[model samples]
Target: MRTSIVFLSALATSVMGANSTTYTLPAGFNVGLVDSSERSAWCSAQRNTCPDICQDGTRLNSCDSNTLDFSCVCADGSTPDVTPFKQTVPFFVCQANYGQCINSHPDDAEGQRTCKKNAVCGSKNATEEADSSSSSTTTAASTTLAMATSTDSTASQTSSVAAASATTSNPAVALGGDMTKYSTGFMAGLMFVAARMIL
Candidate 1:
């Protein structure tokens, strides 16, 4: 009976650990729709493009024929971003094609050509852009705080900044909170069943 208890405890620990495993996307990559067209074309583009983009490992998430939606991401299991369809594509040709698809005047050949050309030329490093934007925001906030001389205000600002930084640095905290709750309940139920069987 004691040995059974020990074995069950070990099994539960392993299972819980497995449940906690989370993957984050590498820098400059995002989970987004590669294309939206016919089922065959969408699926083909997703399957072909994701591997080329995320050579480490690729996860072709979903392809909806009716909705004409298809999405893919790295195998690391990053959460899908809001407005992912509008996010920049890593490849120049894909970006240009996406621009063409979103063109206001789809039937106009000249407009389509201009849109494609602009997209290819305007493609920028997303990671660098994000870093610069965040840094600038932080600097601006710091400048505002510096103008305030109150001790209580400074303390409040410091705490708020710390909390914001914590959440941003560890995205899994928000994502895994629910998973942890579910896993705890599941493990408790399993142990209860095992104890009853052993008794």
Candidate 2:
């Protein structure tokens, strides 16, 4: 049993070096692959430690294994269908979901336009004339600052992110972002394993 924990821990540590994100899905656990609304009710019952920052939309939120599963809810607690006049931007998910609105020409090249120069729905939002790219910059910076200021101790948590995002030569610590949730997921996965062993 001790050997099993060591092996599993080593395997988990190794897998964390990949450069992408992933959660440890135990056998028979649902992955929430479908639309957020259609996700398992039990999963939806799971709570995300972080508040949803979606400006205004029926959002698809995922939780670590410790919680039930995933969730879909309006960011502003409004009817999901009463959207904020959002459009699916062609390529970037961020731009598609979070682009601002403007009243100027669609191709206005000034630094004070709505969405970034890279967004497809660059001319949407609420106001027809008062769009500002500066808003997006401020929003992005605020989000970064929020993540940086999140309350989590590195010493108390473990991460698989380091394995998935960095090279094996140097395992990087999870600096910010979803590391808190990932750590919760990892701990939950470990608990699940231990429970199975006891059973």
TM-score of each: 0.25, 0.19
List the pairs of residues colliding in candidate 1.
none
lDDT of candidate 2?
0.37
Candidate 2, residues 15-127, lDDT tens digits: the string is: 43331122233333233432444233333332221122234433334433333323334455432221222321111123322233222344665632434543433233433
What are the lDDT scores of the predictions, listed in order? 0.49, 0.37
Which prediction has the highest lDDT against the true structure?
1
> How high a TM-score does candidate 2 get?
0.19
Candidate 2 regions exceeding 4 Å error are: 19-92, 97-114, 120-199
Q: Which ranges of candidate 1 are over 4 A from the true structure?
A: 1-39, 79-199
Model 1 over residues 48-68: C-alpha lDDT tens digits? 544434434554444444433
Worst 10 residues of 2 by lDDT: 82-91
Cα error, residue 77 of model 2, in Å, equals 43
